[model samples]
Target: MIEKYEDLNESYVTAGAGKDSTSIFYWGGYGTDQTGITNYDKVDGSDIRGYLKPESGSYNGTPNLSANITAWTNGALSDWNGKANSNVLKGVTTGDGPYTSYATIGHVLNTFLASADAKGYDDWYIPSCAQLALIFMNLTSVNNALSAIGGQQLSPSKAYWVSSEFDSNNGHRVYFKDGSVNGSSKGSRYSVRFIRDI
Candidate 1:
């Protein structure tokens, strides 16, 4: 059984364990950026209210990829706005499938968490790549809370999908084993842990 604790914060709830949950999902199809939305950076009181420009460039092994990842992971919380990124994907209808058709990860997440009986909240979303890194940085604390609540512990061997997209074909993900962020084909299957504002 999963139990909710107010003190546990967003990190705990986003660690892939909660009321009713699964371990893996696709990152979903591509979409345009969703601007002018209010989103949060950290579980703290910090708020970022604007649209973030979509990240550009090639996938892993690029000359500047490391720097880009570093900036994303260590930069402002606003750049890691998974909610807005997920919202963008949610509106997509040109490729893969539409969000309303339940053909993508965003749709699946909405169906799972938007219900009135779903963990007493309905705003859960796929974390951005940087957001996933933040969760990894606090893995110890997150795992502790999961243990307390009888939730599934995030595994180090697993790769988790994030809402950040690299292009129409690839999306970002984080490897828990080394906390490395990289881009992969959206069609690739990986673990997904939802996050929301507290």
Candidate 2:
């Protein structure tokens, strides 16, 4: 069921999903740049639970992050954005896709996030591995909230991509398997899921 930002709230709580693992909120936050590389770096009050929308195309993760990639994360919490920006700075250029050939995840995901609109907000960005983990941590609740609108992945059968890079030739992903994270080739085709700041 398609929803508005006004709809997210505490009622979707699942176990182990809070700052203390015992509560829920309309939004939640984790991770920041200043905190270095910690998984759950909270930046004061970036309590934004991104507005996620599952898209229906597969993209390749190539062209590498060596091109002039652009990072869209600033004044936001996740370093994924900064890293993505840095990666884009390294990208050669941005263009259209069957991105399945040689375009990095940053090129595809960041471009999508930058233009996405959920409810009324537009400050969207990709989730870091840690931020993606948060979604996995609360999958049940996340699914519940999304279920109302015939949303995707109420029972996901595959992994979703993450914006974090493992190196110049690889990227990361997570899904419904015990939050098990792994790396894939940048040129490999994978599923796409976009999330926005709330």
Candidate 3:
């Protein structure tokens, strides 16, 4: 039977299709708000911070190696203040986004990555611009599969950070709105989403 996950933050499916059978991926709230100051709800006592891909099946699309680059960077603006800007935070829709400072954003990112210690794996990454694109490309297929299983769709409009650094800059971010990359200031507060190998 299809599976579903319900939490204080959001609800989504936990499975998908594989090369020859069906698979499911449950949403792990890696990078959850711990302090409760960000106006976002905390689902579990331990902030969830990473995604866990279920076993692959026949419907699961094959992985693409070409877009999986290790290093990418987004450009920065002079106005960066290490705080999340309203335009980037997806969880909160008001006040230039959800962070009070850049440090908070970093804490959130680190929290998610660190809380994942219980999972016993450490290849988790913030994802590069190209990698984010791969997600966008596969979003439809994934979405379709999720729909069949009663999963919700996740579409965040903010620019998310990736481990990839830009050739011209020290950091990079992927603007999901247009599938573009930029060299951003490390101090600037942007959104973060984690990825791990299945």
Candidate 4:
């Protein structure tokens, strides 16, 4: 798991994603900048689990970290801020599908976490590969917590992307179908699942 900022390396040249070319958040200067790279990692006491709401209801207060969560999948909404229709991928009811073709895999997951309003909190962000692994390791507990929502898979039918890459041509992905992990091409359209840190 991305245990700390150092996991990103002193000067990470982003792993190749695909021919499309996507932006990655990095903390270094280009060759002639003359200044050392700046650290971009930030840590605060804010926890995402605090905002995860238990169910849909009249949400009128700030997030409560200690609030009991009833389900995780219930956060899906239609037309986030009315900018589009169907907020969650699985819940999309409009044209094409839940997402437009332009939506990058990373962006979809990030949006899910960022738009979370559970228990009145909205501080969720996408989980890294390591984080997803942690949840996988605690499969029993995680599954139990998410069981209230039927769609969560203890075993995914296909491999899912993690926003982490191994090289210019390879990226890491996890398969819930049988709890297997592997790497594949970035251009390949694979399933994606988003997670947030507790």
Q: Rate the local accuracy (lDDT) of all candidates.
A: 0.52, 0.38, 0.34, 0.32
* Error in Å for residue 174 of model 3: 1.4
lDDT, candidate 2, at 107? 41
User: Which model scores highest in TM-score?
Assistant: 1
TM-score of every model versus the real structure: 0.61, 0.47, 0.41, 0.41
The TM-score measured for candidate 4 stands at: 0.41
Residue range with the least summed lDDT across 10 consecutive positions in model 2: 23-32
The positional error of residue 120 in candidate 1, measured at the CA in angstroms, is 3.2
Q: Write the per-residue lDDT of candidate 2 for residues 152-187, one digit (tens) a residue.
A: 553455565555544444455554433345554444
lDDT of 4 by residue, 1-198 (tens): 111221122111122132122322211111211111111111012321122122223222334322221222122110011111112212321112222323344344333334321223343333434444444445555666556553344443555554443333444454544444444444455544444334
Whole-model lDDT for model 2 versus the true structure? 0.38
Candidate that beats the other on TM-score, 1 or 2, i.e. the better one: 1
Question: For residues 1-198, what per-residue lDDT tens digits would candidate 1 score against the true structure?
Answer: 222322133432342343223334555553433343232232112322111221232232212223334444332332577787777756542235332222345655555565433477766677876667667666677777887876667776788777766555666676666555555666566766667777
In terms of lDDT, which candidate is strongest? 1
Report residue 4 deviation for candidate 3 (angstroms). Answer: 11
Collision pairs in model 4: 1-130, 16-168, 51-118, 53-118, 53-119, 54-70, 79-86, 155-176, 156-176, 156-177
Tens digit per residue, CA lDDT, model 3, 96-159: 2332222322333333334433144444444434455455546557556757877544343556
Prediction 1 TM-score vs. true: 0.61
Backbone clashes in candidate 3 total 48
